[model samples]
Target: MNAIEVENLRKEFKSYSSRSGLVGAFRDLFTRNYKIIRAVNDISFTVKQGEMVGYIGENGAGKSTTIKMLTGILTPTSGKVIVNGMNPHKEREAFVRTIGVVFGQRSQLWWDIAVQESFRLLKKVYRVSDKDYNEHMNHVIETLDIGPLLDKPVRKLSLGQRMRCELAAALIHNPPLLFLDEPTIGLDVLVKLKIRQFLKEINEKYNTTILLTTHDISDIEALCERVIMLDEGKIIYDGSLQKLKETWGEGKQIQFTFVSEMSLDTLKELTDGLQVTWKQGEQANVWTAHAPSALLPEVISRVVNRYSIQDLNINEISTEEIIRNIYEEGVVHG
Candidate 1:
């Protein structure tokens, strides 16, 4: 079953044109001249149950607007959004009951309350039975390692601590769908890793569907199997992460450090066919071209014969570089 479905979804807001002066501001308020700013253009996609999907885009690209519509916090101007086979905006209460939302910059927990107290309040708000609530809370605390932080007031806890509590609070209701927006933003490396692991485990064990939005590519790389990329409020690409890599990620870099200070011009003369993408000093050089995989051994042999060998490294271009290239140089589909 599809956990979330959007079809030709469109949202627009009235944006007024005004000058910088007080007269212009007064005229704008009185005249009400405005233009339609389409925050979310006609875009469509479906996310199946138990799938971990990454929704990524740059700032002001309507990512938050889309999430708000899905969570029933905002209504779209046109088109349809169905969550768990129900219209989210129309069935706000029922829709909210089945999903949990976490925004990294915001807090759902009470500032003055202890972490455990907030959990108890959530238990009542969701009307969770004592037994089920205890079981779920125990499991979440154990998984997120928040047992040590349960008695501390939320305001007193550090960012990482508060983040773990936020995750625990969101999951306390045992919702089947989770919408996480930049959940690891500004977190330390160790805390980020722990959070990622916790999310992976929850998705695997509970079969929960997750739609994670973040600017951090590492988060998407570690968590999502499928990625939906948005640019200018439109769907640019949607596919398996590996396929995106294979399509845009071409060429590899080979770096070599010579044992002796051999002149770059001499090396270039010897390997003139190889595209020397970058050259630095007398000891290091990088090459990229349509060379066969077998050509590496032959090139190394020639280089060793001409100059003393020291160290060499060859690696494929990074995924970040590939995605950036795609965004900069738009993909042309045949």
Candidate 2:
């Protein structure tokens, strides 16, 4: 069975149309004039068991709204969201037992309590067995290096430390599915690397299904094989990371090192009318442009023959460039 099945899911929020004043607030209580904002439009997608999927979009793209609905924090305005074959909203108490959720900017751990105290409370709440809880706690604490931090109050820990603790709290029960929203936000490079490694180990060792939502593209690139992109509350793209690139990205950035430095105008003149973009460096002249793979040879030849080329190489397009190209040009919608 699919880990998640969202069929034509949607969520709408109501906003009042009133002036900014106490009188407006009092009038709104009597009249109740409000406008509907479709935070999530008709969106449908399925996530297979153990699949690592990236749910990404720019601000105001309904990414959070969709996740909230699936987690049962907010009921959908229409359609269905079934997680692990059960309606998340209707079966919330039972469904939460099978999943873990983390939001980078928020903390699930109690502020005034020591970190391990929170863990103990979680054990009781989840009704974890002594054997499983101890073993899992050891693995989580050791893997994340939170042993030293277990005694510290959550309010005393740094953002990065708190985040690590939060992750451990989520995994303490060994839930089959993990929902992470911006898990790496505000973390330093080293901290982010640690989180990524931890996630990889869990997926490989236990086959934990992860649904990650993040504005950080690197998180998506590192953790997700499949991505579902949303635009204005609509599903724009859904497929493997490579497929998204192949369909929208013009692969390969060819770099040329000439015998001598060439100005942009000179380079453009050499490869005229071919949509070639060029740049010059201290040691070598550089050119970055988009060219289809099929016509790459002819495109290369046109430049190589015209200029006194020293050396050249081609590189794969970056994930950032690919996504940017999509948003700039591809008007994908539900």
Tens digit per residue, CA lDDT, model 1, 67-161: 99999999999999999888998998777879999999999999998999999998888889999988877888998899999999999999999
Write one digit per residue (lDDT tens) for candidate 2, span 1-334: 6999998988888997776699988887779777899989999999988999999988899998888888889988899888987898888789989999998888899999999999999998889999999887898899999999999999999999999999999998899999999998999999999999999999988899999999888988899999999988998989899887777666567778777666777766766766544544455465565666665787788877877777788877788877876777766833
lDDT of 2 at 12: 86
- For each of the candidates, the C-alpha root-mean-square deviation to the true structure, in angstroms, is 4.4, 4.2
Point to the candidate with the largest lDDT.
2
> Backbone clashes per model, in order?
0, 0
In Å, residue 142's CA in model 2 sits off its true spot by 0.6
Give lDDT per model, in order.
0.84, 0.86
Model 2, clash count?
0
Q: How close is candidate 2 to the true structure, as a TM-score?
A: 0.84
For candidate 1, the C-alpha RMSD (Å) to the true structure equals 4.4
